[model samples]
Target: MQRKSWKKPALIVAVLVAVAMVTSFCRSRETAPAHGNGAPAAVPIRVAAAHRGDLDLTLKVIGRAEAYSTVNVQARVSGQLQELLFKPGGHVKQGDTIIRIDPSLLQAQLDQALGNLAKDEAQLVNAQAVLKRYSLLIGKGYVSQSDYDTYKANEGLYLASVKADKAAVELARTELSYAQIQAPFDGIAGAPLVYPGAQVTANDTSIVVLNQIHPIHITFSIPETGLAGTQASMARGTVPVTATLPGTKLPPMQAELDFINNAVDITTSTIQLKARYDNHDDHLTPGQFVEVVLPTTRLTNVVTVPVVALQNSPLGSFVFVVNADDTVQQRMVSAGPSSNGQIVIEKGLSGDERVVTDGQLLLVDGARVRIVTGNG
Candidate 1:
């Protein structure tokens, strides 16, 4: 009876111990974190705020510099270059003598023409006197009508000869004046193409190149989308433009829009335009490539955002805005022209809202977020 009673007590303690172990194992399985078989999520990138300021809408483009006036100084008359009056690469004014072709031959021709004209004039006077005598003789019946007609014909021939001689004299004078080549405008003369005593012919290589530097031109092209804005600004009044030298981060020089193409270029799909600058210092040179900036209309009190904050999806463009309660809201936005790396938000954002610029791609709508201190 004592052995039976000891076996029942030991079995009850073993049953209780097994029940406690099973209960503990069940609790641990319920409370532990679940494991995933996939890769970890990407970490959000920290970014700073871009302060809003007065933003100017500037259209940037690459362009080439051009001279407002370019002239190739060619000789109008063929002759030996007698003298180079202006120094090469020096400034010249309008009507300033540049090259002096040998005028001796032209002067001789003029003299010959003048002598011929004088001889013709003397002959014409003698013929008029003979015609007058013939008329008087015919009136008095001293000469036949046929003789008078012949005398009148001879007088007409002499008059025509005198007129022709006068024309030759004028032609000779014009040729003589052309022997002196002069500058056509105020400009800098390029290198002399012919040396002294070099024979030059009309329509051959130019004697020199002249470029007007005081007023210069900058030509550039803009995208077709910006055409309306440009036309509006131009219609309102004069619009200011600027240009800077390529490869040089220099401050832009001011210019005025002087010309705009009537139609877009079919090949480039861009609108060609030109601006005039008063380059009094002669700093701008022809053929120098540059960057052109045309200022368009300004947006007033519009929300502006950093470019990186904007995300692209199949639906449209969106941005992740962090709310006050430390959560993100996906907001769709309409964008406008971007300037200085910042974009103009046309819709879907208020100036008071805070946006996630750097870590937008990692966020989702209603995502829990922690406001990073000093990360603004």
Candidate 2:
């Protein structure tokens, strides 16, 4: 009985050991990192190739559309604002009669001046005839010399009066013409400050503002850093510019660089530029905000990459370039001006390498990669 008991205990111990070993083996298998063919796991990522192409660098800035010219249409003569021949915000042509003042008062003054001139001319003619008679009588001794001299002096006085009267008539005519106000150019007339029957003073009252919308001038500013490039492009020819309104389907309006400020603004560190566009359809209005795109410079046959591929770190800007062996290596690049969606790689790229654009979080330097989409 003792031998049988000892053998039974030994068997139990053996079975327990076997069971513990199996449990430990299973736990080890569960805890180990799984891999196929004992290879490291690959990171899933998308990539775009660093391409070689001519990059036309451009700069986009906010601009304001302004009238080519603006003028304040004021009353030239002081009188009652009798008629406003233009509608508020209406278009007017050059020399179009825009305002008609009450001409009755002006006309009366003109008539009075004209009557005075006629009377003076008639008196002048009579004085000349009397002077001629006096001359003939003096020669014949029928009139005293003093009487002749007096008549001659009177004739000169009448002649001076006639000359003065003629000048008055011209002045009256000019004053009469001022009763009608004309437009100086083809433009949009703003609100009339003075209504009809309201007395307005010449050159003092704010009557209406006229703005020439066609051939609109667009004013924009750029950082002083871009001044050299802009001037270089201008030296070759007029630098081209285009304006567009956001949230609209209209095509970009073409313009040319027409003016550049002589000095940079000290406070803002920017330079102002003006572009002109022939807005024949009158689409662009003064004071309307717009987006202006201007070509700043051009890079020839340079290595470029999507902006997304370029990454920033504490050190500087860099990108992940995929090697021939399907591995990625972080490449330090000298980045230049960015245009559209691409940035010029001024250094560290040979213009044909594939750069990792996505799945960057799953990547490290010298990590193996599978080109999922044949990034090129």
The residue ranges of model 1 lying beyond 4 angstroms of the native Cα positions read 1-56, 246-251, 296-335, 340-343, 348-376
State the C-alpha lDDT per candidate.
Answer: 0.81, 0.88
lDDT digits (tens) for residues 1-376 of candidate 2? 7658789889999999999999999998777654467556677678887889887778899999999999987777889989999989889999999989888888898899889989988988898899998898899889999999888888898889889888888987898899898998888999988899899888888788999887889999999998988888898897889999888899998999999999999999999999999899787899999999998887789988999999988889899998898889998888987898999999999988889988888888988887776544
Cα deviation of 328, candidate 2, in Å = 12
TM-score of each prediction = 0.68, 0.70
> Model 2: which ten-residue window has the lowest total lDDT?
32-41
Which candidate ranks first by TM-score, i.e. highest? Answer: 2
The true-structure Cα RMSD of candidate 2 reads 6.9
Q: Per-residue CA lDDT of candidate 1, range 202-294, in tens? A: 677478889987788898999888888888788878889988876676667999998899999999889999999898877688888888889
> Candidate 1 has which clashing residue pairs, if any?
none
